[model samples]
Target chain A: MLNLNNLLLQVIRLLLTFVIIFLTLIIFGVSPFDVFESILYGSLGSYSKFIRTLIVWTPLCLSALALIYTFSAGMWNIGIEGQIIMGAVGATFVARSFLGDDLISPYLQILMAMFFGGFWGLICAILKIKGKVHEIFSGLGLDFVASGIVIYLIIGPWKRAGIASTSGTDIFHKASWVPTVGDSNFPIFLIILVLFLYIFSLIIFRYTSLGIRLKATGINTFATNRFNFSSEKYIVFSFLIAGAIAGIAGFSQSSGAYHKLVPSVSGGFGFLSILIVLICSRNIYFTFIVSFLFAALIVGGSQLQIKLGLDHSLIGIIQATFVLSWLVLQKIEIEKITYKQISKMFAK
Target chain B: MILLENTLVTVISLSTPLIIAVIGETISEKGGVINLSAEGTIMICALFGFIGAYETDFAVVGFLCAMVLGAGISFFISYCDINLRMDQIAVGFVLTILCINLSNFLGQDYVRINGPLITKFSIPFLSDIPFFGSVLFNHSLITYLSIVLIPLSWLFLNKTSYGLAIRASGENPSSASSRGINVKRMRLLSCVMGGSLLGLAGASFSLYTKYGWSEGHTTNYGWIVLAIVIFGGWNPFRAAVGAYSFGLLQVLAIKAQSVTLALSQILPLLPFPLMIFILIFIQYINRDEIKNVPKWIVAILGGNQPQSLGKKLPEEIK
Candidate 1:
């Protein structure tokens, strides 16, 4: 009976979430049903389109996983945007300088790229820990510095005379690229990797001491401290892990497809990750599903730009609407809980 | 030598909006409510402030319209956070995103249109002071209002009755409630007032400086103001200092472009690193007190304070 009740609750929330999505599209003067159809056909339209969604979904999934870790520990790091940028910067720096066209040894470059990205995120964590700065503001400030660094690279050190665009770094040889599966195939390997992450996260969340300790810290820092748990260290570690995952996502986006560094490589994936986390309510397995759904929306929404004359940003609006609705639902749940508790206390 | 004066001027002028916004934020925080929606308020006002002024050709009208827009938006945040009991930080963030997109969508057509600029006036004798006259006295009335508001805020905070009530609510809600104060109402008022000030600042930019509506012309002043509020220690005077310091960095960066090769290369980024370093320094100096300040204040200022909800009650009937 309890299981049935929980299942019913899940179904209601899912239906509410869809209603929110539909309402959001309607507000923008688009039909949700038509857009939904477009999203389905857009991703599965052709073999090539299906492959494209996977390419986008892989990095998005990695970053979402990283975000879930940080958010669960009660840290809101807006620096994923910059972290990803630095990842690409680091990757480009390595691929161009040392591993240019060397397919035999790109693995080392990839590892270095991940390190640099993670290292940048660590800078934010260290600043928060040692310097006492708040994570959100520091992350925001760091993002600006990172943006300036990218622009500086394009205008100064890595400027190309012939290319008029703002993009920096040179194009990589085909050999330096991360290998895709059979001809025009998406990276199916991501499925296996993300699945592993989902299972690992589920196990850790359900059974591990670290998970319990982290939740305790999140719920009540004073009580957690009384129990001798170092909340600060755990939070910093969460940021480090989150930053590393975001870093990998950045490196993947650049090397797997673009082959050249562009400013939009992160493509607002950081903000989207926040939405995915909220919708899934910090559940790792749920995030994997939502991230792919988001990828489909982006992949399909872009097609809407051409087919339905919708703005490219409609995807952002759709995602934002979903997040806002989830928040409303979450708010309702909190209200009910608070009402129950407070009413009882007042009764006493 | 000439470049120094030019840099000085640019910094002072550029820092004006942040100064105005952060001062309002300081008031909101002192009263113990966080207004995370300042970003949205600022952006929407910046967009519509231009539209109103451009259509009507009145700078004052533009400023007034922006304040209304900001206040209206802030009401939603206050309602959500207070009445609906939503997570303040999360609500503010979501509202911020909403305002950004809404402004972007609204301002898409207004980007090319220009608005009337607020005319600058010099105060009689003080306006005659050599360097200070041109740099300080020769700006719009709104800029001058922001300057005067600093000391005025200090007085209001230290010497006023309502101010004390607001501060009390922020410091200890239960104690204040026992004293017969309406804590929620004070918070709602502060949120709206702070939001209005931010809106006015957004309007001032279009009316006095940018002289037109641009989608991103506010350029994260909301975030910067939030940072400055923290850097200011939630005090209006301190926030002014932080604002000016940031202003100085922006000025120096622009001026250094003609003087050095490398400085120009990364000069735009200079303010960010400086802001981060300053924030870290402030946090280090006030670590103990920093933790003690209310969560609402931290949320309002966009600092790294925990997103606090009211304490949970006992499970069984009392």
Candidate 2:
């Protein structure tokens, strides 16, 4: 669905955006050039940094992909954080069990994580469907509840031997880690899973009847009744699918990144993925590209504190501005206007 | 008795910020807007409120500045919803993230810095009214104002004509416009008013209740306020009760901290789960599933979510 013409327009717009960012940085009394240079160097400078970006990208892209399911089905799915947490809990369960030292533990963790995350999501769906609660409220409530459960498990049942702490259970056994490629730690397992899911999703949305129905349900819930499909069922289906995908994101975080469960197992990436999904506007292709760029931004944001003597939060401010501008510019029809201007030049 | 009295007093005093914020949110919701940016709005306002007081040496100035910023933020959200035809929840959610990080970024220098404190002031005659006076009157000026706002805002929402218009706009904007009301302006106005009150609530946290500025000074309190507004069922008076109950929970949580590492952390989050139940109950009542639910039960607990809350104003209305 994407073409080179629109891509060129986006680049032109990106240049204009950089100018605004440059001015904002100046107003904050920082050297914009230095800030940009450091971010570039930090994320892409070394082989290790590039590997780190891939690690962040795996879970992030997974979450964004998961969000697309619900977004297409027209639900906010804010309980995504809880789903991610539950997935980690599921993985941790396998990591700490009798199977802890076995190579097959990672595979078991994947299934358990999917079930746990899917069930948590199912709870939100049931609340909204049967109990008449809005998804946002139920989702928000479930998010806190899930986090509370994680904290309880960390400090209560799953605490490290001898002394309990919130830093997280001791790092899991190496057998449970996402199988990496070599010394460079390429995380081949996670990258493969991400690619497989993205391809699966693109096919689901493009060629499948179920995907078409989900979009139909999203666009107009009442209208779906005319087609004899239950919108509520699709809502449930979407949450379950989204939650399961988000759970895989949790697996990626646990096995691919930390390799253990922590109180903050989700690491706020679920919410960041929401921001990514917003900018992508449910476009699956854009979601991948945007998620990768954002992962780099986050990986790079650490450099702000170490090298530039700046707060890492500047990354958030920049991203938020990008979303706000994206939403507003979309309303302004920037693409159409750009397309028109370029066409006029070509005709002349 | 003394321990209970003291706890009650502390609950009234500490709940000051929450009560003000809940009332603010109730007003916005009543006018058919969610102001879902409560979390971020309160966060940034708390930072600015502390900074304003720190720079000027007057807590009042800090509050005023916070109110303006709060109003400004709400106005921006409403503009997107009403004018740009965007989703209210999406904009508010984005703003929450933006303001939260913005506050942390801007507030980096002010973290743990000392600022002016809001002082206690008992009403001249009210303080002598035995148990009631001690529990409600003898507290910071902001506390008294928050307590007073409960009844006043209730009257404003249920008694006054302007209140009716705002409620009408939220309840059914199309009907409201058909009746010659300006739904857009009403929403915008209420959003700004509520946003400013939210700002006040944020400032109160820094200057009065919690005291001083820090990164995420108000933190999850904003989400707590959003929950309370619903728990209160969108009524200022009931919402105040909900806010105070949360304050009581906080106090108990602090006391329970000595008992276990996990209990304290979990107690304060009690409201979110409870809010979900309350929301479900409200729906159950709407469906008339339980015929025996008393009228007061519906009135007090909540059967009153604005029909149009968190939705865009219809294009036809514009």
The CAPRI quality class of candidate 1 comes to acceptable
- Which candidate should be chosen as best, given DockQ against the real structure? 2
**DockQ of every candidate:** 0.42, 0.82
Candidate 1 displacement at residue B177 in angstroms:
3.3
**Local accuracy of candidate 2 as per-residue lDDT tens digits, A1-348:** 889977876776666666666777788888988888888888989999999999999889999999999999989988999999999999999989999899998899999899899998999988989997888888888899998998889888999898877888878999998888876699888888899999999999999999999999889999998899899999999999899999999998888889888888898899899999998889999999999989888899899999999999998888887787666666766777868999999999
Candidate 1 per-residue C-alpha lDDT over B1-318 given as tens digits, one digit per residue, 9 for 90 to 100: 456666666777777777888988887777666676777778888888888888888878888899998888777777776776766666677777777777776676788665587777777888788877777777768888888988988787768887887676667666667788887776678778888888988887777656677766676678767767766767787689888887787666666767754465465455567668667655644566455656565543433321222211112211
The regions of model 1 sitting more than 4 angstroms off are A1-30, A33-43, A104-106, A161-165, A189-192, A225-229, A333-348, B1-9, B122-130, B256-265, B287-318
For this target, which candidate reaches the highest lDDT against the unseen true structure? 2
DockQ of 1: 0.42
Worst 10 residues of 2 chain B by lDDT: B295-304
- Docking quality of model 2: it rates as high
* Clashes by residue pair, model 2: none
- How close to the true structure is residue A205 of candidate 1, measured as C-alpha lDDT? 77
